[model samples]
Target: MPDRVLVAYGTKNGSTAQIAEAVAEVLRKDGLDAEALPAGSVTAVEPYDAVVVGGGLYAGRWHKDARRFVRRHRRSLAGRPLWFFSSGPLDASASERDIPPVPGVRRAMTELDVIGHATFGGRLEEGAKGRMARMIVRSGRGGDFRDFTAVQAWADRVGQELTAAGRR
Candidate 1:
């Protein structure tokens, strides 16, 4: 059997979830066994050899559940290869330089010793967000800024890492 990889994500409007699914697909395409699951639904980390956690950024913060998952299972996670990604910086002008680390993410990174981290752009649809989120989206502050090429490239790298780890 292929080595198992768990892709867990927290999403508000489903953008991050979709991204997680895409990442899982890429990994599976490379012959790795992968599954995309919600962060809240993940009760244990014992089934997987490697893990990828993703979350949507809201007001410069990762979703609380994503943070909690890492915290609650830090010990198990520390023993495995871990990767992290965030869906943020939705504006057209959003660039790596413009998007700094979110506070929760930064804190989790230190505790988890995450091996890789990425920031992907997110999407906001009309009439799909709460009043505050709508305001944030309407302020010309958000768009579907996801660059699929970059995301796929990162997945490829993760595949290579997983392959190398399996050989060891």
Candidate 2:
């Protein structure tokens, strides 16, 4: 059977979830069994051969669900190939250059020995949750800055790595 991979994410306005789904789709196209799910909804990672976790950024921190998910599954995650991603930059910077993971995510990467990470631009539009979100949209600063091309390229690289590793 092909290796099973889990792409999980946490998001407030549903942008990060879209990124996770895209990653999972690429992995599936690459001949792996992959699924994207919400971080909070996942109870365990023991069944998957590899995992990808992602979260939306708010106030320089990952969403609480993502943080808690990592803490809760650290042991199992340590034993598997793991990757992380953050989606929260509200501009073109992510597509223009590589954005390093935030301090919190960096610490988790070190602790869990994650294989890779990427930062993608975020999306905020009308009907986004929370007062601050609404305020940002009203102020004309909210827009979708996510680059799906970059997202696909990253997932393709990840799929290559996983496929190569499985062969060995």
Candidate 3:
């Protein structure tokens, strides 16, 4: 049987959710059974052989929902092959270089024994919620910085790793 992988994400303006979906798509194309869903909606992680959790970065921290999900599913997640991703750079920095996880995410990785992590660019376009988001958009600083090509590449690696492990 193919490995069942869950790609769960915490997103505010929905860009991170899109990223998660793309990741899941790549996994499926690579022959794994993968699905993407909001982190909060997931009631259990025990049914999956692996998990990928992602969140939008906010003020040097992960989205609250992502943090809570990790805390809630820590035990089950710790035993599985896990990966994490954060998207929240409104600039080209992420595409140009490696951006380490924020302090909290780094700590979570240690506690969970996560297999890998990636930081992708973020999106903050017009109509985004929050006063700060609005202001940024008005200031002309809001736009999509996510690189779908990079997202696909990373997911392919994840799929390859998982598929190889499963064959053992």
Q: Cα deviation of 106 in candidate 1 (Å)?
A: 2.0
- Model 2 has an lDDT value of 0.95
Q: Which of 1 and 3 is ahead in TM-score?
A: 3
- The stretch of ten residues in a row with the least summed lDDT in candidate 3 is 1-10
Q: Can you give the TM-score per candidate against the true fold?
A: 0.90, 0.98, 0.98
Q: Over the full model, what C-alpha lDDT does candidate 1 score relative to the true structure? A: 0.84
Per-residue CA lDDT of model 2 for 60-149, tens digit only, reads 999998999999999999999999999999989999999999999999999999999999999999999999999999999999999999
Computed on alpha carbons, the lDDT of every model, listed in order, comes to: 0.84, 0.95, 0.95
Q: How accurate is candidate 3 locally (lDDT)?
A: 0.95
The worst-scoring run of ten residues by lDDT in candidate 2 lies at 1-10
State residue 85's C-alpha deviation in candidate 3, in Å: 0.4
lDDT string for model 1 (46-118, tens) is: 9999999999988878887787888888999988888999986766433454454677787877777888888
- Superposed by TM-score, candidate 1 places the C-alpha of residue 131 at a distance from the truth, in angstroms, of 1.7
Off by over 4 Å in 1: 93-100
